[model samples]
Each structure stands twice: as structure tokens, then as C-alpha cells.
Target: MPKLKIAASLLAGEFINLERDVKEIEKAGIDLIHLDVMDGHYVPEITFGRQIISTVMKLTKLPIDIHLAVTNIDHTINGFMQLHPRCIFIHPETSYMPIRLLENIAQAEVLPGIAVNPTYPIDSAKNLLEYYGGVCDVLFMSVEPGYGGQPIMHKRLQIAKNLRPFVRGSMWIDGGINPNWAIEAKKNGVDGVVSGTYVFNDVQPMKLNVDSLRGESLSWRTP
Candidate 1:
């Protein structure tokens, strides 16, 4: 397998010093920047909106990846599209017309993907994978409601195996991604890991924290 790419989520960074945090991530050679747009109704937390994401885009040279965890997918999506994000992942559960929304994202020239919740069935998404997934740059599997150092729920690794056959692009796991979990992810065919707390919630320099995630290896045996 190729090296694991790390998409660091800036939400977990110190928002008061946002510019400095962005600069730190850029210097760390982080491969991608992951942003979450959440409405209180959808995921219980209201994260920032479009303008903030646009600001984040301005602060970095890295590619921006977005997860749409909002209820108003139709009204809010266009604002993000205008920013030309690297990839936009819409939870298939949120849209009544998910296929159409995914198509709209493609029309705007952004890579479109489905973000499967940990409990959502892959069987239900096979067709979605067959269609939009083929052209997508990555399949973003959220395997964490997990923290940075806890043992990965082995079941989560199973999801990667289930997704391995059809995903043409890379498979990325979001949440609770540490090096040990990353080794197991590679064994299961996962190509990238997304982390917010792991990258930002530390006294370690951002370079040490961010670099720790991307260049993971399985050379040593992992049980």
C-alpha cells in the first residue's frame, strides 16, 4: 500500500489563534485540510459556516475537504461549491435527492463523495458507490466517534474491507486516527486518515502532531 495521507481537521485547533494554527499545519506538510459544516440539528454541534471555510482555504496551500453535516443541504451547498473545495462529502442520509445533490457537486467541478455514518449500511450504498464513487477522489469512511489513542473498534476495520472492492479512489477514515489504528487501516486497505484532535489538541508542535499521522507504516507487525 502507498503511504497514508493525513487530512487534518482545523476544528480541533485553537480557534482564537486561527491564523497561526493554519500556518503551523502548512509548515507541517499536512496533505489535506478537513472542514466540518455541522448544524445543531444534524450532529448536535454547530460548527462554522461557509465564510469561515473560505477563510481557511485562504490560509493554506493544502487541499480542502469538506463534510456536510447540515440539514439544509440544498440551500447551503452552493455557497461551499463557490469555494471550489477538493472534495465535498454529503451524508447520503441527509438528502432526499442524494444522487441529484452528488450530481450537482460534480457539475460544479468538485469531487463528490458519500460520507457513510458508522452505522449506515454499505449494502445500501453499493449503487451510490457504483455511480458517483467511481469518479470520486476518495471514499470517506467515518470510523470514529473514537478518540486519538484508544484501540480502534475492530468492526470499523471491517468496514474498510467491505468498501475495498468497489472504491476506485482512496478510502479515508475520519476520527480518532492514531498511528496504531493507521497500521490496521492500511492492512484493511484504507489509504488516508482524518484527524482533528490528534493533530491539534496537543502541546507538541503542530509539525510533530500533524506529521505523526501521514507517514505511517506497517513494517512492524500490528495485532
Candidate 2:
């Protein structure tokens, strides 16, 4: 089994001091920075845009994964593509042709991933797996999107386990992931874990929580 990667979600980061939060996360040895972009339509909230993403891109060299929690993905994909994020994830519920969209993202030379909400059945994304030959670089399973500090729905881990054989690349578990849950996610076949609140809740300037989570994730190997 591959090593589990640690991704820090921006939703739990200090929004008031966005740039500073990202810089601190990078310094914490995070593998990737996860950005949740919600457009009021798909989810109840609208958060950030290309301007914010561009600023974030300028702040850190760490790979960025943008999760599009919106209905109007097409309206913003190009703009975000220009920023050259390491990976872009669009909801299977929002995209008209998720597989084709993933293909387009791949054609742009960026990693393409599909985001599945906790309630959405993994079988619903079967076409994506079939058409793409299960080649998505990342599979983001959201326990709860557009929010922070929710409990990790164990069923989502089952979804990740179900996709293990079909997924050719990496599988990322998002929403409410902390050091306590990282080991279970890895044991359940997750390739990466995304944490937001667990990292920013630390009062220590060095981001002890973030560093500890990353350290804990690395300690769990595939047996």
C-alpha cells in the first residue's frame, strides 16, 4: 500500500489572516493545501474565488487541491485553471459529464479528481470510474462539505474502501479528519486525509496540531 498523504483544508484555517494561515500550514510540512470553493447554488454558501486562489497560489509552493462545491463549475474552471493549481476537484453532482470534465482537466496537465458528498452513493459515480478507467489522481470523499468540525462519517470510509480496487491513483478523505482519525482512514485504504479545524485550533504559533497530525499519518504504514 502507498503512504498516506496529509492535506490541510483551508476552511478551518484563519480566514481573517488567510495568507498567514496558508504559510503556517506549509511550514507544518503539509503535503497539500485543500481549498473548498462553494458557490451558493450547489451548497448553501459562497466562499472565495479566483482572486483568493491566486493569492493562495502566490503564498506557498505546496500543491493545492481546489474542491468545487458549486453548481456552476464551468463558469469558473477556466479561471482557476489559469492559476495552475496542482489538482482541481469538481462535484459529481454538479458536473454534467464528470468523466469528460476529468478528461479535460487531465488534458490541461493538472491532476483531476471527483468530489462525492457523504450522502451521494459511490455507485452514482460508476460511470466516471468506467469511462476514465479509474485514473483520477484524487478521490475526495466529503463527510460534510461547506462546513468544518463535523464528525467523519464512517460510511464514507466504506465508500473509499469500495473504490479502492477501481481507483488507480489516490483516494482522499475530507471533512473532520484529525490525528485521531488519520490512522483509521489509512487502515481503511485512504491515500490521503484532509483536516481543517484540527490544524487551526492550535494556539501554538508553530501549529503543533498540524505537525502532529502529519507525523501521525506518516507513522501508519500499509501492513
lDDT of 1 at 177: 70
TM-score per candidate, chains pooled:
0.88, 0.89
Residue 130 C-alpha lDDT in model 1: 84
lDDT for model 2 comes to 0.75
lDDT of 1 by residue, 44-138 (tens): 77777888888888888789998887887877799888899999988887888887888899999998877876777777776677866546644
For model 2, how does the per-residue alpha-carbon lDDT over 96-190 read when each residue is reduced to its tens digit? Answer: 77777888888888888887777777776655776788468655565668778887776777677777776777888887776667777788788
Candidate 1 regions with alpha-carbon error over 4 angstroms:
137-152, 215-223
lDDT of 1 at 161: 79
Model 2 vs. true fold: TM: 0.89
> Scored by Cα lDDT, where does model 1 land?
0.74
What candidate 2 gets wrong by more than 4 Å, as runs, is: 1-3, 203-207, 215-223
